[model samples]
Target chain A: AQSVAQPEDQVNVAEGNPLTVKCTYSVSGNPYLFWYVQYPNRGLQFLLKYITGDNLVKGSYGFEAEFNKSQTSFHLKKPSALVSDSALYFCAVRDHRDDKIIFGKGTRLHILP
Target chain B: GAGVSQSPRYKVAKRGQDVALRCDPISGHVSLFWYQQALGQGPEFLTYFQNEAQLDKSGLPSDRFFAERPEGSVSTLKIQRTQQEDSAVYLCASSSTGTNEKLFFGSGTQLSVL
Candidate 1:
């Protein structure tokens, strides 16, 4: 079974600070990793995915996540945060052997302006 | 529509009632998925459909939950004997193909069981 974990339930950052939401995964084989953000009253929106190739993956809204194979972590990051960037972020994973996409409980990001 | 659509947007059901949620995936999309999201939690996979085939349903919490994708276009999720615990947002997502495809999610049906 594939699973994802977001260690922190909430991550607080200042408007102009760099922010990172941690995510780790467990899978039998290569992991298909993705990050999604859910805004208030909106559906989950796809942010970025790591299929293969470069360790770093860039996504919408100037968000990026780095896949660290050695640490088994895929942490979503942004060089500079904005107040509007605050939202519930989820880390999802799928294995080659499973059809279900497992998601982490989620991390609530708070960007104080 | 260009995106996945689900209805009714909100459903209120008394305990022991049955509820049916509908999903209309993107045109020509080959894969569909159902997930349940409780308040303050991320979506949990319920089932998956490949075209007209119901391939994997291992994520379903119990036998009371059933889903079908007929004609490979429209899909429905039926919950029998609903309970307060069943109150959640039922989300439907679709992808062009199953493997490694980025999923497009619908707004979802919020089911409230009293």
Candidate 2:
């Protein structure tokens, strides 16, 4: 079985401060990883993905994530936070065994101005 | 071209009633999928279609859930005998490739079963 875990349910950050939301995964084969963001009452928007690439993956909205193979981690990061960045962030993994995407419970990000 | 489109943004159903949700994928998208999302939980896959072929329905929770894409461009998910447990947001997504690369999602239909 394949799964992803988001250790924190919520993350609080101050405007202009760097922020990180953690994610880890367990899979049987190659992991196809992705990050998505959801606003209240809206559908998820794709942020970024890691199939096979450089360790550092850059995405929309000035966001990026570092894929660490040894740690089995893909942590979303932003150089500076903004109030508009507050939303629910989800980490997902596509299992090679099933070819289906498995998603975490999601982490709510709160940015304080 | 428009992104994926789902209809009946909100629906309320009584127990044992039936409901249908619709989705129109982006022009020329070859793959379509339906997922159910419960409160505070991630979306769970319900079914998948490759063109007009219903390729996968492994994730559907029960026999009451049925989906079809006869014309290959538009699809519908029909839930028979609605139950309280069926109350959820039904999300529809599409990808240009059959491998489900970078799926584009719709706003979803919020279903409430009483």
Candidate 3:
């Protein structure tokens, strides 16, 4: 089974400060990791993914995530937080053995101005 | 269509009533998926279709939940005897391939069962 976990239910950060939303996973094989963001009443939008290459993957809206195989983690990060960065974030994982993508319980990010 | 589109953006159904949700994927997308998202939770995979073939439905909660993507384009999810637990945002997504392609999602249909 492939599973992902978002340890924090909600994260608060001040504007201009760096923010991190933590995520970890469990998979028997190599994991394909992804990050998605969702605003109220809107569908989730893809942020970034890690398949096989670089440890750090940059995504939309100045967001990025680092894939750590040893830690089984793929934490979402931002250099500096903005109020507009507030949204629900999800970590997902899929392995080659299954076509289904499993998502973690979401983390709500709040960037205080 | 420019993106995956779902119909009945909001639905209110009495318990035991049946409802059908519709999804229109982007043109030429080979993979379509249905997911159920409860409040404050991530999207839970319900089913997957490749073209017109229903491949994986292991995530469906019950036999009352049914889905089909005939003709390899538009898809429909039918729920029989709606229950309060079934109230959630049903999302539809599509991708160019069945592999590791990023999914394009719809705004989702919010189903409220009373």
For each candidate in the order shown, give its overall lDDT on alpha carbons. Answer: 0.94, 0.92, 0.93
TM-score of chain B of each: 0.97, 0.97, 0.98
Candidate 3 local lDDT, A1-113, one digit each (tens): 88889999999999999999999999999889999999877888999999888999999999999999899999999999999999999999998677888899999999999
- Scored by lDDT, model 2 comes in at 0.92
TM-score of 1: 0.98
The residue ranges of model 2 lying beyond 4 angstroms of the native Cα positions read none
Candidate 3 chain B superposition, TM-score: 0.98
DockQ of 2: 0.66
Interface C-alpha RMSD after superposing true interface residues, each candidate, one decimal: 1.0, 1.3, 1.0
Candidate 3 Cα outliers beyond 4 Å, as residue runs: none
The prediction achieving the highest DockQ against the true structure is 1
TM-score of each: 0.98, 0.96, 0.98
lDDT (Cα, tens digit) per residue for candidate 1, span B37-88: 9988889999999999999999899999999998999999999999999999
